[model samples]
Target: MTDAQLSPLRAEVREFLRAEIDSGAFTPDVDSWMTGFDPTFSRRLGERGWLGMTMPTDYGGRGRTPVERFVVTEEMLAHGAPVAAHWIADRQMAPGILSNGTEQQRRRYIPGISAGTVYFAIGMSEPDAGSDLAGVRTRATDNGDSWTISGTKVWTTGAHIAHAMVLLARTDGTPDDRQQGLSQFVVDLPHPDIEIRPIRSIDGQAHFNEVVFHDAVVDSSALLGRRGHGWQQVMSELAFERSGPERYLSTLPLLRAWSDHLREHGATPNQRVTLGRLTAQAWALRQMSRQVARELSDGGKPDVFAAMVKDLGSTFEGDLVTAIRDASGIVPRREGGTHLERLLAQSVLHTPAFTLRGGTNEILRGIVARGLGIR
Candidate 1:
């Protein structure tokens, strides 16, 4: 896992991305993992055994190292390839299923996930709670052999197209119970009683959605992990979500665009200095992210470490956008602009979300403070 073994695979992925780009499959984009959803490309990766890069062969995964998977994802984000379709499922869902899913659940979901045929949406945030699980009011009423879910989930990315969702519900307690009485479920999508509506972001993307469960019923087998262990299960999954390269590399394609512009149009000395500073910060964030991945591979609960990476990485992402915007002096246009201008437009609009998803910067700081015994 620690060998320079990543080199060959990295080269292979780069070649594939090059070919895809050369063939005009997609335009390079900033934050492509979130905004550039192409299921066909995702299935292409699955065919190459790149989607579930770390799961075991038993689950139809490649059994590669987490660091190795990180290498692949890093390349994808850097290229601005369309990866949104499988990003959530491959990054968190696969690992979450492996960590807490039953054998039956694993058999049913993992193979499809690795094949990029199945997609999942995270049903964590609510209109009131945002990403705060403590404010959750979604209730799953137990109906003997079945559970009836009735509630609303907001900011649910890709719910409109997902096959299922990993959701938390209040199964046995009131709001005062906080962490207790919360349970997780794997509810299938497109059910008659379940409704989904898109929420357009400032960038005019409709990937996020509001999902309403109106007494949607699922069998007892829908439960994930232990009963009333939703908090623990979700916390475990965040280790994968918050520490990845996507946290920082969302703006890299834009930076690359800026770099291209500078190379073609020339830059002042100050602009060169700015580029150097940004690259330095990007490298530092990459190192911290890699360390978190290594710690996870070694079976350590690096929750605080992950929080630090996420917080800093998101800051870097925003900073990268600002630096590029100032240096390029290109008026952003969502449509009919030069390549750099268009990339700048998207990256500019996406900055607000950098510190919001995967837990806000405020929440991440709280995690670090508590984990470090900072009183």
Candidate 2:
């Protein structure tokens, strides 16, 4: 959608957020995408037709373009709205399923996903496989009527609460084969054979999980796309996942809070300059992200470009936090602190994960290098 077309929708979302905040329904939070999970808020967004704006109309979406979705997503992040409950399902899983799932799978999952009633978590990262996803040791064996999946996944965000997970397992290859013979499965969660344990962060939140599947049996029909195509499917999905407003907006709430604090307390000339520089960087990155979204809408992968955007956007996220903290001259406190102080504390705790999640900067750099034939 063009800027003129998007203006009204943007205004509509901003107004909705204003009303929600004015009523004290939810507090604006730093890293709200990851830590601020509110199912009620997610359902509210779905009711407004904001959760699955890009999906086809037949599948309960608004049949909007990615650009329209981009407007709503950035606005939500900017306002620090709690979107964690439906973030994963709406952002990538639904798209993935639509692109690579069977008709039965699509009919079964898409409606609930668009309605914001179903949630999903990624099952790619393992204890030993962080950036090297091809090295995952999770194995799935065919059992005629069902697939017996066995292994553990670590650093799984929201797995404990997710209704299902898009699990990647080695169905026909060894670790030596890297990406070959891998497959994806839609595994329902909270089953008797699956165990979920919390991995607490420095902030004492259990958003991340360690999930173990001990012969977890899922229907044979749960396989997504084609067997041995899981790597390719996941790569396509990451292009969608890594190149969004979320990459740069994770610390936006903190940035806005600090900006307000400066406005109230007065900032020095140097502080103003630093804030301007950060704002410019964020604007440029947003343009880059929007370009990627447009590309996805046009059926283009733009993987390398996506990786580059993610690398730079994540770096900027960390830099934004540091710059805001340095300029504000307020020490972050975990308790009994001002809003700015609390947001700063939250930002500091989340800084390290900024570059790590959705593929590390180190891995992203490699992707860019290979794409440019630099390596």
Candidate 3:
């Protein structure tokens, strides 16, 4: 659908957000999708048919198109709505499952995900394997009807609170093979053999975790897609994860707030120029991200393009935060501060991760280069 066609949906989401904020349901936040863990807000979104918009209607979703889903998601992020509780599931895991899960798996997880009653965490990154996912050493051994898994995953977002995690483990082959023999399992959380501990960020928020699986055993049915295909599956999942409105919109609340502040207090010509540049960059990145969403909806793999979008989008997010800070001359204050000040503080604290999550900018550029046969 065209942008004009999507205008009503945008207006509808904005209205809902306005009502929610006016009623004091929640405050707008910077990086809300990562830091805002409001189950109630997520459930409200599900009730509004906003959570699993692009999934099939048979899976309890609205069966909407990617453009439609993009409209809703961009609105949520732009408004800084608290959406983190269901963000990973809706954005990445649900699509992964639909593409590779067994029928039984679909029945078990998709509906709950659509209802916002289920949450998932990613287990692709380990202490030794940040962007080098091929270096992951988590091991899983076959035990007839089950697999015994043992290893530790670091920087696992929301694993402590999630219902399950899609863990990547080496089930066979040598590390020299790199991507071979890696497998994914839908390991349910809170198992007896699993321990999850919080990893606080510079903002002092415990959104990340260190998850250890001590001989944790899961049924053979827990395997997602084909065994030994984890690398391919995960690469596809990252395509979904990286190329999203969230990448660029994390600090949008601050941008909006800064714009309002500028209008109210007036701005110097230099400040106006900076704001214009930032706004133009955000607009361009949004279009790029939308194009990737269109490709995904059409079942096309635009991994290289997705990488480009993420690389540029994340840089834009961090640059936008810095521009806003400099243009407004606002010192970040954590507590007892104005909305703009609080958002600036949060954005500044979260800026370091913008280019690191999903995949680092360096790794993303490498992927793009490889795709172009430049290396």
Which candidate leads in lDDT?
2
Ranking by lDDT: 2, 3, 1
Candidate 3 stretches with Cα past 4 Å from truth are: none
Q: Name the better of 1 and 3 by lDDT.
A: 3
lDDT of 1 by residue, 193-225 (tens): 999999999977899999999899999899999
| Candidate 2 structure quality by residue, lDDT tens digits, 78-184 | 99999999999999999999999998888888888888899999999999989899999999999999899999999999998899999999999698999999999
**What lDDT score belongs to each candidate, Candidate 1 first?**
0.91, 0.93, 0.92
Worst 10 residues of 1 by lDDT: 1-10
As a TM-score, model 2 comes out at: 0.99
The clash tally of candidate 3 reads 0
lDDT of 3 by residue, 188-306 (tens): 87899999999999999999999999999999999999999999999998888989999899998988999999899999999999989988898999889999989988889989998
How many Å off is the CA of 154 in candidate 3? 0.8
